[model samples]
Target: MNDLQQQLAAIVGPAHVLTGEAELASYLTDWRGRYRGRALALVKPGSTDEVAAVVRACAAAGVPMVPQGGNTSLCGAATPDQGGRSVLVNLSRLNRIRQIDAANNAITVEAGCLLAQVQEAAAAAGRLFPLALASEGSCQIGGNLSTNAGGVQVLRYGNTRELTLGLEVVLPDGCLWNGLTALRKDNTGYDLKDLFIGAEGTLGIITAAVLKLFPRPRAVVTAWLAVADGAAAIALLGRAQARFDARLTAFELISRQSLDLVLQHIPGSRQPLAAPAPWQVLLELADGGAWADLQADLEDFIGGEMADGRVQDGVLAQNETQARQLWALRENISEAQKIEGLSIKHDISVPVSRIPEFLDLAGTALAAAFPGVRVVAFGHAGDGNLHYNLSKAQRQDNDAFIAATPQANRIVHDLVARLGGSISAEHGIGQLKREELVRYKDPVGLDLMRCIKSSLDPRGLMNPGKIL
Candidate 1:
């Protein structure tokens, strides 16, 4: 371990290598505080070459390496293992915006650059990155690509995999694969970029990427609508899509319980509607047209929905400030839930058409087994992903509720499997869902994944015990 640390320090700098327990504490845990790991040392590489060199040193010493960016992974994908035999490769020093090609509607950036920084860079170039996340200001792009993150705007812009055009990776054996092309369509051979985009850093370490951009929206209308239930929310989504088409940028379903939690826990959060319905949706329409006309069209469409009894009540943001405030209610949900209590969280996705059924069945099953279980469900309805979480009702012991996680997971995941849904939606299978992946993934697909992992990382010294 001493010799390996010296070699890594030589590759980067002595000052960048950290071995102190205090210095490594923050990097050892996941964002949710659910996973705590140990490492031999934390190495901060300054460039792609330095990263490759560090990987080569680790490979030679047979030490596993965990590639980490901002340490903001929800599934513990970037955290090292408890064995303390691995080296944590911190990528924050490699942060850089290499180039911006507005003509090609793309931007190339180093892995350590924060998501908000990328969005601001695109906005400076009069374009939109459109990959919005509550953690954008803190989460790094490498982690985003590694997880293939999906946000509310995925309804229009797609996930991180779709927004990405190219990647520069440091292979497990210290080789650099520079496939950073900004071309829109290249039917050259196999789509190599897709493999690493959502592999959760098990295949290789992502150093940089070429990301797609879109024209800035000239007009945006944000609205909060009250619906009957998840079924009504889906119906409203269909109606909105039929009328607004591609202009429907976001459609988020928030249950009344979710909204109430935000209202109670988040200060200054006011209800968007007068009378509380069983469910609500936060929708947005954006386009390259005049702002006034865009708002008018959205208002007209919403008025018709109200007249048809699809929407009970709604509120259109008067301006951008109001729009941002409305978004705050949706974005602060996770934080609010955190303040409320400990909960079993699931980032699952089902077929868009079966979302209502999934919700109904899962809720019923959970309620029957675990009495007084609070189901705090909300997420991107347009993309069929829901952050379904559970907590005990008031006066119940959270530890007791949490002890039933395995049972809870079986109930929820079995129903998801029956309805053709994913156990891990945008979040990848890190240490958190490794066992679940084994049970849910097809045998053939799992075999192929194992073969690829073995071929690339034959030594198994790259992010060990993750995804695989």
Candidate 2:
């Protein structure tokens, strides 16, 4: 073994270190197949102490460390660098649910637990861990926290950052900070948990977390509404919010193109409306009460909107199965896009009220610039976040179109900036959008980020070449 490998093996037993190409293949790439990297070795540590030791050894050797969870990063944030000089610290073996405090409505869990596992744990205790993402089956809690993930339920429960109360992190220098308190209100200093929640593993390695829980929604009403355009959808959202209040759990926008792709790719997906409209909404209202009345509320609202000529057509899910089927269409969009081909994707967020204007301007500009290009735009409209993706209609010229990604990004990102939207809504600034972050981030914001990075990681060894 080489000097570095020998040291790494000593830190975490040699049996836990994988160096062969075959064994290291899965750890070196991302889930989306967008990034394929080379790693010197893949190390699996069973405990935070071992992780700290590994980090210290890597730091001493000047070798970069890439912390990986379930390897489900949509923005290539969890993958190692292409330079092949880093070691991947796989956290899957550390999966454990440490404690569950029902009274406090908090769960202490290790970072490697799958999101689904966390949700199930919460459900078993008669509470809800409301960060529900499509990738919950495979994505780890640590990765979700690292990205500060926002999902369908963000309209009601907020993002991963809001769901978390405290964290246990291993600093860049291999010292563990035990901040795993389940306190609901602590005015103690700066909220340290916030720093690591969305740091993308650049600041430190999150070992475990104290996650907040909520009362389970006793009733839910799911509906699919056909709208004229973004403007009408925005208007409908206002009306629904005025009526439903906290029961408004989700309000997602779907385009005709996005629906067509899902129906084409996902099995058993059916058209919810009789005719395809230019815009559609997959909305849900949930509450901790006798929710059978919610269906009536939704029907009455949709009827009034239709009478006012705001809604073209609408369909309410009759049962749980129907509701899930409708949701599958929206959730499988990313998978369908993957199966289809390469596309330029942007997860952007503008103000809730400005969504209509932003869409009109961006869609028109993109259509004018790239004629015949398919723009598959859809997302959590209630959160003013859209997954705006562009692809060539034909496969033969897809590569050529993808090569102009920078030019395309300029069009979308410029508008997002003008409308006060984030270029990366939920996804963090991985290597994929590092330059865009540098270009679009405010000068003061960039300087402040640099100062924080320098203060925490002075040696510049933790997940090098990411976020900055």
| CA lDDT, candidate 1, residue 13 | 86
In candidate 2, which residue pairs clash? none
| TM-score, predicted candidate 1 vs. hidden true structure | 0.98
lDDT of 2 at 261: 92
lDDT of 1 at 101: 96
lDDT of 1 by residue, 111-175 (tens): 99999999999999999999999899999999999999998899999999999999999999999
Against the true structure, whose TM-score is highest? 1
For each candidate, what is the lDDT? Answer: 0.93, 0.91
Global fold similarity of model 2 (TM-score) = 0.97
Off by over 4 Å in 1: none
* Candidate 2 deviant stretches above 4 angstroms: 1-3, 10-12
Q: Judge candidate 1 at residue 324 and give its lDDT.
A: 95
